[model samples]
Target: MADTPQANPQTARVLSVSELNRMARDILERNFPLFWVSGEISNMTRAASGHWYFSLKDSGAQVRCVMFRGRNSYLDWVPKEGDKVEARATVTLYEARGDFQLTIEFLQRAGLGALFEAFEKLKQKLQAEGLFDETRKRAIPAFPKQIGIVTSADAAALHDVLTTLRRRMPGIPVVIYPTPVQGKGAANLIANAIETASRRAECDVLIVCRGGGSIEDLWQFNEEIVARAIVNCSMPVISGVGHETDFTIADFAADRRAPTPTAAAEMASPNREALLNTLLQQQQSLQRSMSYKLNRYMQQLDFLARRLLSPAQQLTHKQESLAQLGTRLQNSMLQLLGRQQEKLLRLSLNLQHLNPNAVLNRGYALVQTRDGAIVRASSQIAAGDPVNLRFAEGSAEADIRSTAKPD
Candidate 1:
């Protein structure tokens, strides 16, 4: 292949691969800058230098791509093998390798709306399986004895959560279950950490947290497996994965969702001032109730004392009334006795006028039989029957030797 045109003397002076590659890169960059390119990624590799190398391919051809550490560090999403992505890149050269490549400045999932749609579909599928059920969610302890933190140990989110917890509730133990928060295998690692924390039963509540990021950066929390682990964990979980508006599957799966790391700490802690205020109000109400009851009892005592009358006073009043009654009773008895005596004398005189004994005393003689029966008729006398004669001065018994009947 080198013999035909490259054999010529003039053609031997042609630029080296490095020189040509550099010139091509400069010209391409000058012409097309900060432009977007859409393609499927292949052969993706992340080097120890934190740089990314990949190939962008379509049905027709493929091109080498590079994302230096500086640009790669700012990327929210890392391209994976077979992933379709759009990159804001600069056409440049790899001088040492003498290769033409695209140096990416920014990278994002191609067709973000499509990605979101796929995400939603997966979320719905998991939800239908009860993976997002509220019943399955563990209750966040009102006061967690120990808080288990699931995040990258080196992440700023960890420090934020720690600092906030220390400030809000001092002496509360924090158990860190460090895991990979981003990049490859991060989702699996985070999911396992959650499961481990739950299985161990070392913490009362689990906080799955991370610093703020774009949607792609927070994608691990949106993964189905990670979300499932969070929902299935026995421990009460609180998700503080991103800013206030950022939401993920993990957030939906957690029993409680906090907007930020600081907010999560707040949720786990009680406000000292609020508790104190409540206690004070209760004490004051008790005091008021006691005072009211005491005052009512005191008034009752005062009323009882005012109504009380000494026995001596009651006896003196009764005795004074008794003396008046006794004097009036004596006068009434004397008047009644005088009237009764006068009435009795009049009755005796009237009775004397009515008595037959008075007539007898005036010189009436009465005859009586020996049986003490007066003989009014001679027919009442029997022969040899005894008779009695009565006189006004004295009555004497006389026996009638014979009875005579008037002829």
Candidate 2:
């Protein structure tokens, strides 16, 4: 340990190692003030307690740094390895080890001002144009004959949207209007594709989308030409560009904005499972209606046969015919009785289904007031109120008791 100098050992007082480190820590903290430091971050570690540990280094040297959770939690941007950053920190020494370090208070990127300014300026200009008016937005067709898509031919967004559409409603035809979604002249290409789809009028609705990227990479979707093209389109337009957090100018101008391309495809089509269930219900209802009608007609035919001949005709063949008619009448009465018994069985089952006795057969009991109003909640009765409990086997009266509210 480095300590105070003593020329004569006999006359000097010795200090412990702890005392030396304490003096060094005090001197370092007292001499240096909090200031800004610029460097590339490396060897970053985040603890379970939310504290961050890292080394900030330039070409020639490196220094240990820490940003406590309380200070760093409010920052919008997260710093990572190899990122050039400027941190405002306090220069201090760890009292235990006597090692130098900086305690970071704030952090930021080097060049965010210009892009932020451009984004704000463009947003204001578009708002003034009133291109995003709610009245101008059209409703998408619930069941479109054809769907059109405008995006890069090789984008991952195309694959996601196509897969969702195929799974939801494969019978609906899809039309692809390929365009360059980035780089030079991408905005103009997107605008022209919109215009082309409008003139053809082959599609019921159109989807314009792209994969997620940084502000510079997604700038094409934020351009003025693309927003105007969406407004001029004859068909309703949907904007599904980037991830859920990403937004673009085209999103405001379109009829609807979906967070992702897969969600956009889902919004465009109806679920197949629900449709199949509805068809099945309709079929069963039709069969029941037809059966009832056929039974009614057979009963009318038997009545007409009985009316065509009378039992008073005293001829051998006539008597035989009358006997036959009597047998048919007996058979019809038996058939009607069988149908009535079947209906009674169905009614019995329905009544049993609605009865609350089955519930009480289990361990549950019903509490009611003395006048017989069933208690549904603990709040309905106060503490020390007299009540009766009716069990599945028998009824019992209970005196005043304490009540507790449900958690």
Candidate 3:
């Protein structure tokens, strides 16, 4: 024998419990992919940390399962013990306990898998056809004159909607088109009622609503006929079906989606109290503006009245001005007459000094030739010339004496 192949203690491989468990978990995770499992829930416990601990078992086997808070928080409904459910999970081993387990990513009611698949398929088809395009949606009237409703006559949803409408706006008229909202042929009847409302064209807006229920109970709204009818309706349509957590195909096709029937009525009507408040504010503003304008106009009228003059006062002022002008004219004329008289007296004195007859009266004789030329010098008279002499009062005719030079 080859010395019995003695093992070396220093070279032998050994693993701790934690390392072994970790290796097993990695191996299980790598081998089994995430997959769906269907079973009844048992040993359900909701931890204070919001995590869920449970066991999924069938008739033959059971497995430990855990769903973290992040995963279960998005679920609309809570799962309970003895509830049949489907889980999508991955296989793993708990490192501390050395136990095999599953970590769940999603959970749903056991039989709803087919329904969810159908809903997703239809949603994708309609989206591809542009049925859910925002451009195709109509605008909801802010003040609808008339409202129309399509629902079962006996539905509690109808009562809720009517009460909301009446409370918000009682003056607006509401027309109801009774139709079946559930059961075998409910989709076709709802479509007919919508089409009838559209043809009549009596309402500014339409509401199609029903109360909350399970997915199966609300499945009629997921039909193609109802969606097409909502898309083709003449007026804007508001769809309020099921609770806030529930959604149907009609919600996508409608102009607006409400969480409940009461919300849909609120969307279609305006509040009377709010409108009255706005009107009151506007009326007060108008009254203040008018009062300000009237006061300003009255002040202007008073100012103009002060500036205005009477016809009699105007005539009296003109007469006073005319009298003053006449007095000034009379003074000017008297001064002019006195100046003219003084000028005439000076001229008369000058003329008297230049008169030849006045010189003759002062012992001087005026001599002239017979032809009437006055003799100014002794040289102008000749010894044989005939001459005439005139005094201030008489005239004499004589032969010229001899002329002599004055010594």
Candidate 4:
């Protein structure tokens, strides 16, 4: 108000402070590129629009900050007031307010151990969430017919595993899933292979392994993506990353952790020699059990045989009775024959007494009258008769004239 701006209208029209600031903003924004900056956050405010406003300051200097939802949401962590933070920002000016500010695309706590601390915090959180539970651990099959190995094809660990498995058990077949075991995309490749192997369901168990290396070289296993993949796998996973001392997040998340790749193979199969020994022991035990059972049966049979009666003794008792029967049979036959002989003698005597031929032998001659007459009582005499006489041996013939009856 003190200055006479009307006296020089051209100068008045030349530039206002706000106009100059706006022009400067356009120029600076057009020319400058995005860069990283470090400072502690102050006066931090989050808008309902999902935008963040804050002041970034160091010991003496300070800058304004704005993180839109698009960029801020990608961050896994957020910064609070009094928290030292790093920002990827572009130097730009707000034309309306004529104030310079930083548009932050990303943010991280500023410290050397920030990443490690974040990792630990996440690990503890996931562990508490039961993601790293022992109950979820699966027992490896004792004798897998087919085994899937997820490792680099050219890795020495693969050879070591194969050699060990061959030595311990030569019968099992191995399916190899060639994947990067250490590198930028190693974790993703491993996870994809594991998923594929599970979907195939061809192998009973999977071995996700690699050769030993430094922690940084084996960082792929440390990644959370790999750990989650291991946890989500349906098949039991044996993590054999690095040496015994080297552990990664994958190791904790896996169903089992092997001390070495060779150990992983050993766990996948059973030792043939041990199996043979067990079978032989079982056979021996069966033989012993059978022998004892057979001996018991034989002893029972012997005891029963001793209690049995012999056929020879029963037959001897019957034989004595048979002798008495034979004597009875012979005596009955003799009595029958004697009775028959007596009847025959009686019949002969009766025949002799009544026989006419026998009477002839007794001197009683019989005569025939053929006109031979046996003179008994009939007509003992005839007045004029011719008679004939007959003896036992001879006869004489005669003529008969007449016969008369005597009164």
Per-candidate alpha-carbon RMSD to the true structure: 19.4, 36.7, 8.3, 21.6
Q: Which scores better on TM-score, 1 or 2?
A: 1
Please give each candidate's TM-score.
Answer: 0.54, 0.51, 0.64, 0.49
Largest TM-score belongs to which candidate? 3
Looking at model 2, which ten-residue stretch has the lowest summed lDDT?
307-316
Instruction: Please give the TM-score that candidate 2 achieves against the real structure.
Output: 0.51
Q: What lDDT score goes with residue 153 in model 4?
A: 93
- For model 2, residues 289-402, the per-residue Cα lDDT tens digits are 999998899899998977665545447677798899999999998999999999999998988776677778886678899889998987888877888998877888877567
Candidate 1 — which pairs collide?
Answer: 368-388, 387-400
Give the local distance difference test score of model 4: 0.83
Q: Order candidates by lDDT, high to low.
A: 3, 2, 1, 4
Better of 1 and 3 by lDDT: 3
Separate clash counts for every candidate:
2, 0, 0, 3
Q: What do the candidate models score in CA lDDT, each in turn?
A: 0.84, 0.86, 0.93, 0.83
lDDT of candidate 4 over 154-211, digit per residue (tens): 9999999999889888989989988988878888998898888888888989999998
What global local distance difference test value does model 2 have? Answer: 0.86
